[model samples]
Target: MTDPLALRHEHAFDIRINFDKRWSTGPVYGGASIGYTSIGEGSTVEGPMLTGTLVDYSGADWPVVRADGVVELNAHYMIRAEDGALIYIRNLGYVHRPLRTKGQGPDEEPDVPAYFRCTPYFKAPEDGPHAWLNRTVIVGVGQRQPKVTAEDPPDHSLFRYYAIR
Candidate 1:
């Protein structure tokens, strides 16, 4: 007999959303508000089978921190494929994680309840090479780090996606 709980995933892509600055609207109903957007050489995407860069002047992410500590982020961006086909992706995720302590590794993930997870929806040309993106069920894991100044690497939110089969 096969185990029904067993699941599989295929590597899709990864990205680093470079942070430039941040501004927040103080506590309001349900939670606080955050608005994020970037332009000009936005970011890059690379992986086993995907290659693209976010379109210059077309990216935004709004992440809100609730009074209870969970963060809700909605990111919208356009990617220019190596073949020049344009793809739009909206990735929404949530987290209730604590900031990294003194010696945690950059790529480590906390236990459940502090987990950062996301679901990505894509819009690609129906007849294009990336049309697979449109129908596949993709899930992603995300992590946000801290950094400041142009000299230091900008703070970035990292994400990797996989298609469930």
Candidate 2:
């Protein structure tokens, strides 16, 4: 018997992103994000890893800061490939989770549930060494950590992504 679950274990690389405080007048969760992305997957044969910037926005049902459920996010990226090549990525996905607490001891409140999952499509220059990424499909799993506070709404959010091949 073939184990379908085992077949899905195609491991790729992981990504860690940091945002520079989101600004929006529309609403709390209604805004765009422009930040830096680092290659958390470590080094390969290449001299050094590439870094890039990201532009992302929330969908209609955004600002779900207080809501406990799934929220949608759309993003566009321009990244430098490992070989100093350029690659663009488009993402369509959602984060399903709840708010969090700094800590949860035996007597403390329960921890908030948070998880990020998305599908990213890559586009590479036809003549670049990373052109192969143009045809590869990638799925990402991440964790969301929204700032915890009393007066401050969810302003800062961080995510860590793991690629699935």
lDDT tens readout by residue for model 1, 25-70: 7778766766554533567888876788888768777778777577
For 41-139, candidate 2 gives per-residue lDDT tens digits of 221221112244332321111123223344566665555555566566676677765544655565755576566777867777887566655666566
Candidate 1 local lDDT, residue 157: 74
Off by over 4 Å in 1: 1-5, 37-42, 99-113, 149-151
TM-score of each: 0.81, 0.52
Judged by whole-model lDDT over C-alpha atoms, candidate 2 comes out at 0.48
Question: What's the lDDT for residue 2 in model 2?
Answer: 69
Where is model 2 more than 4 Å wrong at Cα? 1-9, 25-69, 98-113, 146-165
In candidate 2, which residue pairs clash?
none
- Candidate 2 accuracy as TM-score: 0.52
